[model samples]
Target: MKGRGQESFVSLPRFAARLYNALTHTQAIERQHREIARDLVARLARGRLLDIGTGPGRLLSLVHELNPELELFGLDISEAMVHLARKNLAGLNVNLQRGDIRSSGFPDDFFEMVTCTGSFYLWDGSEECLEEIFRILKRGHSAYLFETYQDFDESAVQKALKANLQQESLVRRLVTPRLLMSQLRMTYRTNEISDIIKRTAFADSYTLDPTSLGGPPAWLRIRSTKPAARA
Candidate 1:
């Protein structure tokens, strides 16, 4: 968690890594990952994919299940998270590494698509991170970012709550709402996110997607592209 004026980047601690891994396994969280995976899988036929802040690497693992041929990579600032991602992604061809997004070590124009979910809010150097994303992403390709928003669509929240009430897991029904409320207070609004991206090289090349799933319509799914090379 990072405050508005925080100067330091915060990585989840080892203990928090364990707890987060467990929480992501719950039915509600799994559903969220699946929605993201399905969308990503449907968009591209084949290319390299990078998941920044790949906590526990569950989303990459789910993506792999749908499309085994796609080259998958996961990066996180937390060594514990990288270790857990490697463990969870075992037996799969996915690559997992520990690195910060402010200045990722990947080569320029490398990845076909990049994704960061639920992690963009914690970045203290968002502009730097977006610049790095632009640098590593191939021209004409896109990066998908999903972050929590403070002013989420109220009707969507009620719909999500109703869906959760029908779920069998007691924890999902009770704990998810509380978690959502806490995250809403800590995260950005769509306009704030828009402003940040506008300050980066990706300015004029991003759009917001309305379709998202998880706890509610609280997730802002922004797709930003590196402009294609002209002939």
Candidate 2:
């Protein structure tokens, strides 16, 4: 989903957001969210954390459960998503905002950790967004970007489908796998993503983790740190 211009800022509306909330409640998705939360909490056990494109807010919920002392924040381009996330995360101490990634409305050097999952591909002006991430993240902190990848072996795809979607409803079992596979074809390959990250300050301090999700080879993680070279 590489792109340029206004089309890059996509958001899910009320109905789509509701459907998304339901569809993503599978074991596979939950496992992915848990892994991401654990990795972030392990790296920065207690600090402000910002989750961009926080659809349904599942990841932040997990983070809070893992470490309730950490301050949590979430940003999404869709108002409906923000509302749904708020309802889902009711009683939790989280700050949810409606905004765009290219221009996150936060102070520079503000957050200890930043994360985006399954939504990085929809971003337009990705380099600009990366710069924003670098600017807001405190020096020596990190940002983890997780997205579906396109270069998995066919057997891996089949195994993932069986593990993640086999017990789903007939419609979901049939439609979800096909939808995911199609998007997989359209997503960034590891090298393409590497090239893009290479254009930003994170280039010097980033590493790719092919098995970050700890399940199928369906997702790729790009962990980038802001250098502590400057004060």
The candidate maximizing lDDT is 2
What lDDT tens digits, residue by residue, belong to model 1 across residues 1-231?
535522332455678778767655677678888989988889877989999989789999899999998999999888888888888888999888888888889999999999988888877789999999999999999999987787788777868766865764777566667666776788887788889999999999999775557546778788999999999
Global local distance difference test of model 2: 0.84
Best by TM-score: 2
TM-scores for every predicted model:
0.90, 0.92
> Candidate 1 overall Cα lDDT vs. reference?
0.83
Regions more than 4 Å wrong, model 1 = 1-11
Shift of residue 116 alpha carbon in model 2, Å: 1.1
Candidate 1 backbone collisions, by pair? none
Angstrom error of the Cα, residue 61, model 2: value is 0.6
